[model samples]
Structure formats: C-alpha cells, structure tokens
Target: MTPSNQRCSVAIIGGGAAGITAAAVLRKRAPQLSVTIVEPSSTHDYQPAWTLVGAGEYDVATTRRRLKAVLPAGVSLIQQRAHSFEPTSNRVQLEDGSILEYEQLIVAAGLQTNWQLIDGLVDTLGKNGVCSNYSYDTAPYTWECVQGMQNGRALFTQPPMPIKCPGAPQKILYMAADHFKRKGRKVELGFCNAGPAIFGVPFYAKALMQVVKHYGIATHFGYNLVAVNGPGKEAVFETTVDGMKIRHIEKFDMLHVTPPQSAPDFIKNSPLADAAGFVAVNKHSLQSTLFPNVFALGDCAGTANSKTAAAVRAQAPIMVSNLLALRMGSALSAQYDGYASCPLTTSVGKIILAEFGYDGVVMPSFAADPRKPARRYWHLKKRFLPWLYWNQMLMGNTGPDWHAKREYPDTLPSISP
Candidate 1:
C-alpha cells in the first residue's frame, strides 16, 4: 500500500535502537508531538546479545521482538524503506514513491553491512565452515563451526573501522577460545584485523593484548580479509607494506568474518551526509550541520564515538532534549559527550568493561579499576544490560547520569613497553 502524504512533528528514518529510543523519549516527554518511524523490518533486535548467541551462551530467539509490540503508543509506523532524502524541502521519499513530510527529522537508519564486498562470501556463508556473528541468521552457525572444530586453524577476521561494535569480532574469538579450553579442544586460533591494534582505545588495547597472549591466539595486524574461498576453506587477506599491496592466503578449518559496513545507500547519497557518508551532525549537539531541524545518532551519525548500544543510550536523551529545546525556541543545553561503552568478553565469565568519552578519555561509572576483567561485569553484560535495554531504554527511561561525572584515578598503571 502506498503511504499517504501525512505530515508528522517528528519523523524517524529507522526503527533500530536509536530511532525507537528517541521516539519513546519524545512520546514520554512531549506526548503532543506526532512521531512516525519509517522502517522496513517487522522485528526489532537486541543486537548486543548476538555475541552471546554466537558463543552458545544466549538464546537467539530472545534477542528479537515484533516491531509493533515494542513501539511506544500513539506513534505511527511506516513499514517501508526510505529511498531518498529531500532535506531542502523537509521531505523523505520512500521506496514506494510516497513522500513523508516532517517538521523535524531524525536519521538513525544505522549502517549497512556490505556482505558482497568479500568475494564468494554470499555463496558460502552459513556453510562449509564459513560463518559470521554479524547477522542473526549467520550467528548461530558460528557456534556450530566452533563446536565442530576439534583441531586445525580457526580464523576470525575484522574489517576496517566504523563498523558497529568494533569489539565484536574478537569477543566471539575469546568465547570460542574459552570454550575450547573448557572442552579440552586443541584448536589453533588466529585473529586477522585490518587495523593496527586490538582495540581503538589504548588503555583497553593493552589489556586485550594480554588476553590474546593468554589464549595463545595469533594476532595478524594490518591484514584485511578481501576474499573467502569457502569451498576450499581458504581465506585471502590483503595488506600494504612500503606502499606496495600484498595478498596472503591461509587455510582454515573455520572462519568468522565481520563484513565492512557503511551508512545506508539513501543516507550516503543524501545532501546531509558527510564526506565519510555518515549523517553529518555535530559531534556534541547531534544536530545536522547543514539542517538545524534534523538530528542523528547511533551508527549513522558522523561522530567519533564507538558505535554501540551504549552510545545510542547516551545520544538519544541528549538529542531529544536538544530537539525539544529547538522546538521551544530555547538554547540547546543538552550535549552528548560521546560516551560509549564496550564490554569486552575476554572469557566465558569475565569482561573488561571499556568505557570512554571524547578523545579516548576514560570514564568509568564504578570506582573499581576499569582496566581489570571481572565476573560481575560479565553478569552485567549477559543479564542486566539486556533487561535495561528492553525495559528501561525502550520504556523511555534514561536512568541516572552516573557515567558523565564519575572520576577515575589519574595515576593508574600503564602497559609496560
């Protein structure tokens, strides 16, 4: 059915974490506002739990819910893909050629996973021991590959940066390593990362290096997975040294790939996008640089913060507050400090919760040493976070402001050279 040319006070471009949370907040704080979300999918996913799903620790079924069930009351739902944005005219063109007009727009369409970028990946994914935790369907196959492996090489590949949850590629690796250790499986593990470090934050990267050392996992830096010959169980990686590109092929019994990601096609081609193709918004205000009536958050926002649910949690309230202020003709007081958290699963029962703000400043909520892995954090990741996401965040509760002002020791120990 073609969508009617209905105008809304606020129109969200995606029904993912950012869009839903923002709509929920607007419904609670400003119930008079007519909010509409344009999303193609019928189900909303709690994507953070997919890491555990791939580790065989969490049920994949629990991570998803029907989109209509989770949406806040009185908000309109447009179950269609956004084809293009006409920012100058304050209108969005849907895939069905229907136009949606909004006084204010929120671009939270999230990033796109380019699976076909890797040669033969689409043909062999979920079979021939080629799997990935990136998709809900493929995630379960990763666990299957891990469980079936007795020996030989197990390889995990991480694409270049800006992918949602950068720590995800290695999180499964650690879980698989811990699983093998418990089951007395002698699988040789290797991590192939296109980036130069295990993590973006130096403080956590140092700690993660120790975890990699503990697992006896081979670390291949600067190696980018370019092709996957799944039938032959061989993976190809390209790298550059001395300005010359080189391709390296390695045989593997099992391979987990994290595909390259970018903003959705409609977003990339829109005038609101930056040079990097993400929604061009202020790093702090989240207001579109070109259009003040527009805002963005989550993976689609052109911010330096790590793309995670935690970032969306922080960004939603700030964006909502600022948007409301703009509507009220008041100064935009709420500012997002780029706070994002990454709970790195180093083992089955331990997690190194890496929390940071702009410019990689350590921002720990708890007083405990933020660098150490702990069992409590594991429980938080496995249990509390999911509950908070479904009940609190989606329910329009932002909780307390504990992360912004929490202080940490200045003289914390550093990694030795």
Candidate 2:
C-alpha cells in the first residue's frame, strides 16, 4: 500500500532506549520541532534486568511496558519497519513502500542478535537443557535449567566481541554458580569465551579472576561455540591454534549461549554504515561522519565504548544536544566521554561496580576501591538501577554525573574469598 509523502522536522529510527529518551528530551527542550519515531515494536523492554530475570531473582514481566505508555505525549509514532535509508534525500523508506522525509535523521536502531549463526541451535534453544538469557522468552528457561540440574557440567559460552551488555554472558554464569552454592549442589561450571580475557578492563578483569578462582570455574579462552547437539547433550566449540582452526566437542548437562550480534540489516546496507556495518559517527560528537544532519548512538553506533544501556544514558543527552545545536546552526559543543557502567553480579548479594571511560580508565562513583565486591552495589543493581532506567532515564532526566576517572595503583588488589 503506497501512501502520500510524509515529512517531519526530525525522524528517529528506533523506539528503544536511545530513540525514546532522545524524543522525550527533544520535546522538553525544543517543543517546536515535530518529531516522529519509526518503530515496529508494540512493547519497550528494560533489557538490563534480564540478567537478574534469568537468575530467578527478577520477574521478566516487570521489564516490559506498552510502547505507547512510555512515549512522550507530543511525539508521533510510525508503527512500521524501516526498509532502507536515503540519506542523500533525507528520506526513510518503510517496509510497506512508503517514504518519510525528514529535515534531520537519528539512527538509534539497535543491533540484531544472530541466533541462527550457530548450527543446530534454533532447533534446541529452549529445551534439551539449552537456554539463553538474551531473549525474554528464553531467559526464564535459563533459571529452569539451572534449578533442574543437580550436579553436572554447566557450560556458558560467550560469542565474539561487540555484543550488547558484554558482561551478560558471564553474569548468568556467576549467578548460576551462586545458586548451586546456596543449594548445596555440586555443579561444575565453565566459561567458554572467544576473547582472550574474561573482561575488557584490566582493573575489573583482575578482580574477576579472583571470583573465578573462588568458584573454581574452568576458563576456556579463544574458544567459540559453533554448534549444539541438544538431544545428544553435546556442544561444539572452535578455536585457532597457530593459524589453524580446531574444533572440540564437550558434553554438558546444561548450556547457556550468547549469540553473535551485528547492526541491523537496513542500517548496514545503507551509506551511513561504517566498514564494520555500524553507523559511522564521530566517537566524541556522536554525529555521523557521512551526513552532518544525521546522528547515531547506542549499540548501532561505531564507537569504542562498551555496548551497554549505561552507555546509552550517557550518549542520548549528548546526541540530543549536539543534534539540536546542528539544527540551530550553532557549534556542536556537547561531547560524550565514552562512559559505561557494568554491575558485575558475582553472587546473590554482592556486586563489583565496574565503571570506566575511554582508554579503559577506571571511573568510580563512590570512594571505596572499585575492585571490591560489596552488597551495596548489589542493592544498587537490583533495586535502584531499574527505577533509574524507567522513571528517570526514559523521562529524559540525565542524573548526576558522579562517575569520573580516578587514580588507582597499577597492581592488582589482594585476592579475597
């Protein structure tokens, strides 16, 4: 069905955290501009809480809301999938063969999870002791699998880099291990990571090694999950040994898989995409390198920052401010410092609040040593963060800027049990 030409002052490409927050901020700050969001989903999800949900600590239903309920009152919404982008004409093509023109475009469309990349995974994802926390439907099954297992090898696999919430794959591993410990179940846990290190930041990684040692988890670096024989209760992993590809198969009582991810196809095929298929934006300004009138943030943006919702919270305001400056014919003064936070859930009542900025500089919001796991951070993660996300962040309120680069010793802190 073809429709007449539609135009707006600004068009947002996704209704996720970045798009919704940007729209709310624009409406509050620049009420005169006509904003329209192009999104097909009927519900908005607070995905950060999914880790807790998978661990049986949170309810999955509470993480979702009707899309209309969260959107600001004045903004317009187009409930259709975006098929393509015509940046040269400032137009976006919808899946239904309609064109929407705009004076400015914001590509906040998030990345896509490639579940089918692993062979035989789709056929046995939610059953046969294989589950994942990446999806709302599968997350509950993760807890189910953990509870049903009495004692056996429970393998957790992390795909290559660039997945949203990079710590999520291991977060559930720690949670499951903690659950087993509390229940007096003797379950063997293993972490199969494609990356060489457990975490990106050396400061946090050093701390995490202590936790791993405490749990006695076998760490398999450079190993990537390639296939799952669910009925057979086996998983295949591949690794490179001196430029040669080697495959290893292991038996498991349960498996948690974090699939590979990439930018959505529509954005990847567009001219706005960088070589790696993410929106090419200046790291500091969050403005598209190709089109001055275009901007991008969140997981889709080609930036060095860790892809987390905390990154979205920091990027949205800067993107909105810089975008507004561009519209007003002023200098883009707002800058993003690549700040992101990860509350590593070491156990049910403990967390290591890992915060950092560009170049992996340790940034701590509190005075205590950031490497130490504490119960306070756990409460912050399980109680305060969800409220901050839904009530404050989604309402366009950028909270206090407490996180900053702080000086700490280069050596690792003493390991504790």
Top-lDDT structure, candidate number? 2
Q: Once superposed on the true structure, which residue ranges of model 1 sit more than 4 Å away at CA?
A: 1-3, 405-417
Show the colliding residue pairs in model 1: none
Residues 317-370, model 1: lDDT tens digits: 999999999999999888899899999898888888889998888887887777
Model 1 residue 66 CA deviation in Å: 0.2
Report the poorest 10 consecutive residues by lDDT, candidate 1: 408-417
Q: What are the lDDT figures for the candidates, one per model?
A: 0.91, 0.92
lDDT tens digits, residues 64-90, model 2? 999998998799999989999999999
TM-score, candidate 2, is 0.98
